[model samples]
Target: MTIERTEPATDAAERTMLEGWLDYHRNTLAWKCEGLSDEQLRTASVEPSELSLMGLVRHMAEVERGWFRKVLTNEDAPPIYYSDEDQDGEFHLTESDTYQEAFATWQAEIETARRNAARFALDDLSEGKHRRTGEQFNLRWIYTHMIEEYARHNGHADLIRERLDGSTGD
Candidate 1:
């Protein structure tokens, strides 16, 4: 599948700007993983760190679920790939873990995030609070943070992809 990432509009409204950039980053991550084999997707970049393209997809799926479903909508959405006992379960892939499943789950979470965010204005407070500070967050803040999160992870993805196949771009 071709991942066509459009540039965020410069003259758009605040919400459009935010959503555009967020989706851009989302697509960036997807593009990074494009055309790679299952073994390549599962290959780690460096020693010790278990960061892989597939793992990033799974981790982002969890992030989307946590912020959008569990926090924004206050739904009883448990982690699909992780738990308290194994905080980074998504990053720790098994022999059965596949790119198709990880990407499908991530895309599903993104759809749910869009639906949840559509119900609230940017200034609306999240139904759930921060796990660390116990402070509630506005949708604007959530959007901004999610953009940052994806941006950071996408950088890692870029490196991993480069290491895997020497392909590089935004």
Candidate 2:
């Protein structure tokens, strides 16, 4: 599939601009992984790191579900890729992990995230509290954090892609 990413609008409403950049970073991740085989997707960035494009995809799936489904709506959303016993399960690749399943789950979570976020205004408070501090968060904070999450991970993806086949771009 062809992954297309648009530059976030320079002049737009806050919500529109936020979503645009969020999506741009989302597609940037996809673009970095484009045309690679399952083995490539599963390849780790370096020894002892266990960081792979596939891992990032799975990790983001968990992040989306955690923030949008659990935090935003207080739905009974559980971690799909991790557990209390293995918090970093998403970053650890098993032999059976595949690109198809990882991408499908991530995309599905993205859709759910969009739907959940649509139910609230940017100023709306989330139903869930912060796991670390017990602080409340607004939808606007979630959007900004999600964008930062994607942007940071996308940078890792750039290096991984470059290592995989020397392909690089912003």
Candidate 3:
């Protein structure tokens, strides 16, 4: 499943509009995680939920990998996050991994996603079919879906980070 991206947009305005939403979503999620201590970042709100600042960062790494690389780019690389295994890998409760490591992974994944997205014109229809559903979605639609998903999670991150510490937006 190779993703062949065609240049679909002929104008600058269209390109900027598409890029803006991607930028907006990335910033929103990062803003939610800003200014917290290691302890604060690791704290989950309560039992029965695995969400935490660190966990979100790890999960989003996998999210980026899934949508951009696997789905959009049609890469066969395994998704970054594992459900049955790698439990501690994302939540990362141990003192072994630093904030920098988790943050870096997210950054690198986003950059990879950005490069893949840039391969196409903003509205270009995707060349690869979705792996699971075999449905077709344009590059534009994928960007919009990512923005919506990240925005939703970022809201949850906002409340969690707030509780972790009084620190707020960047």
TM-score of 2: 0.98
Tens-place lDDT digits, model 1, residues 27-88:
99999999998899999889899999999999999999999998888899989999899999
Query: What is residue 39's positional error in candidate 1, in angstroms?
Result: 0.8
Model 2 C-alpha lDDT per residue in residues 38-150, reported as the tens digit of each score:
99999999998999999999999999998998888888888998999999999989889999999999999999999999999999999987777787789999999999999
Model 1 regions lying over 4 Å from their true place: none
Task: Provide the clash count, candidate 1.
Answer: 0
RMSD for each of the candidates: 0.8, 0.8, 7.2
For candidate 3, what's the RMSD? 7.2
The 0-to-1 C-alpha lDDT of every candidate, in the order given, reads: 0.94, 0.94, 0.73
Task: For model 2, give the 10-residue run with minimal summed lDDT.
Answer: 128-137
Compute each candidate's TM-score over C-alphas: 0.98, 0.98, 0.80
The sequence of per-residue lDDT tens digits that candidate 3 reaches over residues 64-123 is 887788777777767555655764456645666556778888889999988998897656
Residue 105's lDDT within candidate 1 is 98
